[model samples]
Target: MSLSVSAVPPLLPAASYEYRTVRPVHHGHMGEPRTDVLAAEEPLEISLVYGPEEARRRRTLAVTMRTPGDDAALAAGFLLTEGIIQHKAELRAVVPCPDVTKAEERGNVIRAELVPGIVFDEARLERHFYTSSSCGVCGKTSIEAVQAASCPVLPAPAPLLPAALVHELPQRLRAAQAVFDQTGGLHAAALFRPAGELLLTCEDVGRHNAVDKLVGHALLRDWLPLHALVLLVSGRASFELVQKAAVAGLPVLAAVGAPSSLAVQAAEQFGLTLLGFVRDNRFNIYTHPERITG
Candidate 1:
């Protein structure tokens, strides 16, 4: 049941950005025509299959509007952070759904098949979720519905990261974002070691999707309980992003922009180190500052 990254079934690749012809206008005059690199926004339908081996059932989990790359990771990360599946061992395979009418859109739908013998209530699917490229997951209906069951109160931050190292991470993350550099239209999530090494990075139109992709990427490689790493996001830290990081056992969540009031509250509740305004050689640690030194 322990599958290495090479042994795991691969998800089909898709374009993260695309080119389109557009007219550039400077001041009041229309400038020359140019090809613009725009982040590709497409809906990814995530489906789940689980049941007894003899009788399997398929259910649609969520349809997320995201940049087209890392579709499988998005699904797997979504499932893990959502507490639907705990680890990669629960997943039998992740592949693009081939039962689509449009050949081009085949890459837009991904399927995560769970190993048989997992028990979950089918009625829980009754609460429909509305996901967007900007807002992450929505329509949870209540606080209980929105809360992730996996996040435990993380212990004190140990082997603390240097404040100087945290300051330079935004640049390192920016350097790794190839699609964002081209389109200037994608959000990113990255992991870093205490020594400031960039471990992994993922970019997507949806900020939440980017984090999900990170979770998926790590989950497939059996990197759960990511207690030793720090997570950095390209945008503001939202409660949803904080929840995802906490569930993945990341001790610190830093954002280039501000943290919402709700995000701060959630971080406090989950015993996570919430940081914001992590740019211009400065950053703010909102909670649990024991993890950062100097």
Candidate 2:
């Protein structure tokens, strides 16, 4: 039997939503004001600390505008997907950076301290200039640069499942998305077992950040190389999302929306199963259709 997880994970920030008063319009007429919930969007600075114990080095890695929760996971996911650190052992600890000059900025910063003596790649840091909530690859120089990154070859003859099993994933993912239900504005990523058991889900204003948060959680739980499971996204599948899934070694990726051209190419290149428009009992298999049975 699967165990229930009630406690929160470590390093997760508080509520991901906020309440605001707004006037609603009914039949082009202004209605009474009411409190509305909105997805909280804020800047999270992911920084890294490395080097020897006596004299460690630190630097801001990337800044992302995301819903304020599951931050440590976001940092971890970004590092692994960006090919910075390969595994969870590379991370010593993920904590809030308290050295900020502004008190308001204190908890908004996350510092990932790398295990001492690990090789640090300074060049990889140069490729990413900035990441926005809407686009994760905003700072990447080119799609070629992203595709060129090393990825493990997925095993041949991927797992197969009934079409009905895959069709239910979007609904399952939607049910797990507590934040999106409240704000109706956040994007989400979810993981499931090959047998269709839901594992974890996360939400963020940025589609990429949601994927990263799920990755980070898996990393901390030693669930890397998610080779036997499927990944689902609440929005369109982008090339960067495919790259992130490949880096994490996921076998199948399903989207409730469409897939970009580059995303299809990346899925084919990485040997991953890509599914799009997975809703209403129908879906499109962009790559490796052998993985989805009748």
| Candidate with best lDDT | 2
In candidate 1, stretches whose alpha carbon ends up further than 4 angstroms from where it belongs are 1-14, 128-148
Which candidate comes out best when scored by TM-score? 2
After aligning candidate 2 to the native by TM-score, how far in Å is the CA of 185 from where it should be? 0.6
lDDT by residue (tens digit), candidate 1, 93-119: 999998989876778889899999987
Runs of candidate 2 exceeding 4 Å displacement: 1-14, 129-144
How does candidate 2 score on lDDT?
0.83
Candidate 2: tens digits of C-alpha lDDT, residues 131-192: 42366453333345655555665777667867889989988888787777678998988888
Model 2, position 256: C-alpha lDDT score: 92
Question: By TM-score, how accurate is candidate 2?
Answer: 0.90
lDDT of candidates 1 onward, in order:
0.82, 0.83
